[model samples]
Target: MQDWAGVFIPLVLFILLSPGLLFQIPGKCRIIEFGNFHTSAISIIVHAILFFSLAAIFLVAIGVQMNLGP
Candidate 1:
């Protein structure tokens, strides 16, 4: 774990999780047309995308491989 030396993994996890906790999934999405994206599914999709993006960026910056192979 050379790349993870002296690292604080919990901080990265917190950053990745904060968006989901803080985002207000609108009851009715108004930014688009011909679509019903106000559902919980859509909100969850957006949250997942955001979380992954944050994780990707943070992990890359810290020089870690984005993998969870058992």
Candidate 2:
């Protein structure tokens, strides 16, 4: 159960963040395609950093809790 909690914590955070939903936007817009999908230029860097940093933080918290044990 504790191990499951560790796994679910990050999963829950990711679901709440809904980062995958970003991909659902239509690709027709030049900014969407060029800014996010095509390259990691200045335009999309902030968003990319935010998503990964949040994900890493959540996962690390889960890992720490798991290591501490019940």
RMSD of each: 8.9, 7.0
Best by lDDT: 1
Give the alpha carbon lDDT tens digit for every residue of 1-70 in model 2: 3445456665765554342244412234543442233323443454456556876775665344554455
Q: Pick the candidate with the highest TM-score.
A: 1
lDDT of 1 by residue, 25-60 (tens): 433444322334234666566656766676666666
Model 2's alpha-carbon lDDT is: 0.48
TM-score of each: 0.42, 0.31
